[model samples]
Target chain A: MTITKKEVVHVADLARLDLEGEAIDRFAGQIDTVLAYVDVLKGADTQGVSPTSHVISLFNAFREDEVGTHLEREAALANAPDKDDENFVVPRIVG
Target chain B: MKLHQLTLYEAHERLKKKDISSLELTEAVLDRIDALDGEIGAFITVDRASALAAARAADDRIASGSPAMAGLTGIPIAVKDLICTKGVRTTCASKILENFVPPYDAAVIEKMKAQDAVIVGKTNMDEFAMGSSTEYSAFKPVRNPWDLSRIPGGSSGGSAAAVAADMCIAALGSDTGGSIRQPASHCGVVGLKPTYGRVSRYGLVAFASSLDQIGPIAKDVRDCALLMNAIAGHDPRDSTSAPRETPDYTAALKDDLSGLRVGIPREYTEQEGLHSDVSKAVAAAVATIEALGAEAVTVSLPHTRYVVAAYYVIAPSEASSNLARYDGVRYGFRNASGTDLLAMYRNTRSEGFGPEVQRRIIIGAYCLSAGYYEAYYGKASQVRTRIREDFETALEACDVILSPVAPTPAFPIGEKVDDPLTMYLSDIFTLSANLAGIPGMSVPCGFSQEGLPIGLQIMGRHFDEKTLLRVAYGFQNATDFHTSKPKR
Candidate 1:
């Protein structure tokens, strides 16, 4: 199955990416090539086989519900691109 | 031998014997990096001040007769750029995080520091660990020490290159799909990918969460084991960390391979693109194991053909979800040219991420998209189950499996960068181990006709790193391949 340029743009929008003229064409081609290669999975016989999300079977790794030492606000906000003293500043979400 | 060329164990012994100070060892390593890294491009950031301070502290600790001194005490070790180092700029070789300094040390970094291992620098990698070759790194591509024109296998290319060039005593590398072992094979060093949960993944910038594992790249098997001893264990921070007891990896190193059963997977040997030289070298390695009294047995992994197909779908899908957090808000690069929130995110991500990363994200999003999920991601997961079961059944017949690490040695820098499918196929042999959550390692086996190094890959049962280390140690003990260093 070939991926079209329109599909590529749609996927990019869903992925929150901006693809311009050349990049859109390039990504569409590359993604199509990869998809064509990976289409071999459709031939594999996986009847009754359960999908393995995690290789090691561990579940509900719960710790005690106690407050612990966490990253201080200053440190947490240290790498923020734009931040006030209290919170990170993004483009106004609710205009 | 120069102080910089000494293995982690040798350096530790000298420090313990008062024959050398940690300051001197660290200085030698820093000097090596200074002289060679300009050509090799192995380091993204060299923390000279912090490294020296840590070295001096280690020296004082040793002098104080502190009982806590460990193998990595006072040893300068490079870390791959993806693993978070507190206060150090940890860019996963991407523009998105070019200047980002992590707020805290990763779990492995914390463990290494507890052993007093000096943090020499953060090494380069594929941008967000996306590519097989370090060519995808935003800063620069890491050149193989053996051949300057060749690419150092990556996304942990810098870690392996640094170790091979003696820029550091040892280094930490993360393996998602051949990130550690492939580069270690190409650079002619030792690298291991512990079972998925064998090493805590906390603070490692996620690429493919289930498949990503932080392991060691070192000069030899013993040093790899030493680094593993320091880093492998359970942590409350990583939910996937194995709750099992950590064994003394060094204890697993014995010169005897007696009573060992080595599995030779027919599918691997018969796989397309297996280089003639690599096949010969691995054959010779199997013979060496047999001479050491190992019983060779043929094993079959029927699902080997589908590994790359399955891996690409699964890894990128997870990466797409994991990387969605980098949308110009909390940290990393931001392009403020956009007028709205959605536009800001799109502009920031497009401008920040490199081409290969953006491509993977797009592919991943497409795979996990509503209409295509069942055919691509879901089918790939089921194929993954068959691959895992293939290993389980094959491993039941033998103690460990051996194969060629890569189809061939390090290729020239730009050879496969444009051809992503070829690059993905190069990782075919290494991806199965990760897919199955089994421990795998690469040890230098022989040199190709053109003088590039070839590595023999040894894989073992889930959480059975000891046997892999044991087989590697035995082979290294019997052969001089691991001792052949790259000429400057």
Candidate 2:
């Protein structure tokens, strides 16, 4: 399966990455090669086989739904690139 | 004797007898790092002042005759850059998190702190544990201690290299598709990855959640066991942390594997690209195990070839979802050129992430996108089930499985960096263990013709790390491979 530059651009868009000229072509080629390798799975018979998402035996883990001591507001904003007293400052989303 | 030359157990014995102080040991390791780290590039951040302060405090506790003396008390340990160390910079070796100092400690870090392990530094790694070689690290590539030109098999390269060079007594590393064991093999150290959910991943920067597990890289199997004793247990904060009882791992360090059933997987040794030296070393290891009275039998994991392909799909799919949190809003790097929020997200991610990381993200986004979910992820998950069942069937016939840890020893830097597929295939032997959720370890077996180290991998059933450690300990007792240091 060959991945085109257009598909690479689309995937990058969905992934919230802005790929420029060289990166777009490089990704297109690399992704195509990787996809072709993984394409071998289609030949294997997977009928009636249950898909595994987690390797371990997992059940719904639960605990008491009570208030717990957590990171403080200041600590939460500690690594923020740009932040106000109570909120993180992002580019204005709406006019 | 140089304090940096002491293993975790050796240093602990001296500390207990009051023959040496924690301060002296910490200073020795600091001195070694100062001397040797220029060429190895093992650490991204080294907090000498804080390490000294912690060492002094440990000495005070020792002087006070405190009953809180633990196995790891005051021994200097370095953490991988991926695990969060509270108040210390925890960059995942990416330009994006170059200054990310997490406020909370990872569960493993908290355990180490409770035992007063002097955290000397955070070691370098591939950005978010994404690459097989540290060549993809945004900061600098970590070179193998044995030869400066060869790459230390990564993304645990820094941890393995540090332990090999005696920069720290031991270090913590996480394995996602051979990150820990492969590097351990190349650097001639002992690395053990416990069963999935055995160690909590509360604050490890997610690479592939199902495949990612934090383990130890140490000078010997005994030190690996000691590190395991300190780090392994249930954490309430980590929902996936196993609720099973923790065992004293060091108790399983028996020299005799008399009744152990060692299975030799037919598929592993028969792979086309396997190095002849690695194969010969592994065969010699089998002979050594047989000499110790364990029966070696042939076992088949029929779905082995499909593992690398399946893993690339599942791991990246999870990584895409996990990495979505790294936008410019809450923390980490942000681009100032974007005028709007969407553009900001794009520009920040595009500029922040390195080429390999961006490639994986794109691959993940493509697989999970609307048109091709079932053909890729769904089918891959089915193959994953097949791979897991293959292990189960093989384990039914034997107690443990043995194979070569990596296809070859450390390759030259930049050899396969440009080709992602070839690099992915380097992990063929190790990735199946992760897919199966079994405990596996890399113990130094022998060296190559040019003197690069090779490792023999021993795998055990779920939560059966004791058996794995037993086999490794037995082999190590018979050979001096683990004791041979890389001559600089």
lDDT, candidate 2, B1-488, per-residue tens? 68999999999999999999999999999999999999999999999999999898888878887756889999999999999988999999998899898999999998888888899999999999998888889999999999999999999999999999999999999998888999999999999998999999999998888888999999999999999999999887878778899899999999989988999999887898999999999999999999998999999998888999999999888898899999988889999798999989998998899999998988888888887888888888899999999999999999999999999889999899989999998999999888888889999999999999999999989999999999999999999999999885
Error of 2 at B439 (Å): 0.9
Model 2 root mean square deviation, Cα atoms: 0.8
What C-alpha lDDT do the candidate models reach, one value each? 0.94, 0.92
Model 2 chain B, TM? 0.99
Runs in model 2 deviating more than 4 A are none
In model 2, how large is the Cα lDDT of residue B38?
A: 95
DockQ of 2: 0.87
lDDT of 2 at B390: 94
What is candidate 1's lDDT per residue for B118-155, written digit by digit as tens? Answer: 99999999999998889999989999999999999999
Which candidate achieves the best DockQ against the true structure? 1
| Cα misplacement distance, residue B140 of candidate 1 (Å) | 0.5
lDDT of 2 at B146: 97
